[model samples]
Target: MNIELHPRLAADCHRLGQVPEGLVLLQRNASLPWFLLVPATPREQLHELDPELRHAVVERWNRLAAWVARRFDCTRVNVAAIGNVVPQLHLHVVGRRHDDPLWPGVPWGQTLPARAYSEATLASFQTELASALDLTPAPR
Candidate 1:
């Protein structure tokens, strides 16, 4: 049950370092709109994840995807669990737009990261998602 995030994931998840129980740090390039749900389980494979956690992971991804879709007003949602590069037990829920940079193709291409949200925007999203995600106050 020894599991840790990949370096890339760790760096991307730095903002959620203070996240508390029930909330997971979803990481991605933040440019093409991607999300990875890090379940609390210490499994390196999805099958290794317990039933309860498996369900929770699914629910989390779906809910987050819905939120992103409504917020971004996207046309479709493409979600999957690609463990090819990082073998962590996590799920990806991506919001796809017909006019997005990688529209009509997978959004896995390399590119410069997007402009990070201002502190205000981050606070706003975190707060907006609080009720749905049960987000807690990040530790000071």
Candidate 2:
């Protein structure tokens, strides 16, 4: 099945590529080492997926979080799928450090501007993330 990404995601994230299970992994533009795991299926909630697909998504989420923790050396990793505004079924895996701008609070409601990556930095990050994920670039 062909899976189309949500336009909002495309706008706000840099596509790191797709995993074998069809999760189109994305790196958010923010500087928090945040990534989004989006199932290609056009669903608004995880419960709507078939058992096998749902399990795969959860497994991928867990793996991504662990990888982020080790790679970023962050104090903690936060994972969530709150679709209040976008209403799309996507999981966010974020690496959090105690000294971060919103240290004791969640990253979602912060008012600070997102940190932007330079073109070179973004390219380097994409390379590292794709290598870690062992994923091939998906057709944009």
Candidate 3:
């Protein structure tokens, strides 16, 4: 299988976005510490991925959840698979907080879009997370 990420994700990849190591993308969305993980397979749908790869992705999610919980002091981690628009296989790992502006409710459709991170902040967070994750660049 090839690794064909969405155009936005591809742009993120090129920009060297701070997503978790081995888990491609890890884009920081404007909402609830949202991040997207692009598995290194040319798979558009989740079911198309082999079981092992699927398991690996899940593992990555778990690892990332831990990372988010500790880093953000989030009360919970929301991991979802909703391929409404981007059909490419990806996982959404969100850092949640009870006091978060939209706590006790779904973050989606509950608030305005995210604000882009400042250059310095984005760079620092990216580097910090990448180091903490101890990521290994996946093979193509």
Predicted structure with the largest TM-score when compared to the true one: 2
**CA shift at 100, candidate 3, in angstroms?**
1.6
- Residue-wise lDDT of candidate 3 within 1-140, one digit each (tens)? 24556776665432334233235454544456766667766676677788987777777777777877887899988887777767667777778888777778876445545666556755555666567555543332
lDDT of 3 at 131: 70
The TM-score measured for candidate 2 stands at 0.84
Q: How much lDDT does each candidate structure score?
A: 0.62, 0.76, 0.64
TM-score of each: 0.78, 0.84, 0.73
Winner on TM-score (1 vs 3): 1
Best by lDDT: 2
Residue lDDT tens for model 2, 1-140 = 35566777768777767776555454555568888888877779989999999998898888888888998898999999988877878899989998877776898856755677676765665567577765665544
Q: How does model 3 score by TM-score?
A: 0.73
Judge candidate 1 against the unseen true structure and give its global Cα lDDT, from 0 to 1: 0.62
Alpha-carbon RMSD of each model: 3.3, 2.3, 4.3
Q: In order, how many clashes per candidate? A: 0, 0, 2
Of candidate 3, the 10-residue stretch with the lowest lDDT total is 13-22
Query: 1-140, model 1: which lDDT tens digit per residue?
Result: 12366776777653342223234554434555565666666577767777877777677777878887887788887777777787666666677788777777776544644646455656666676676566653432
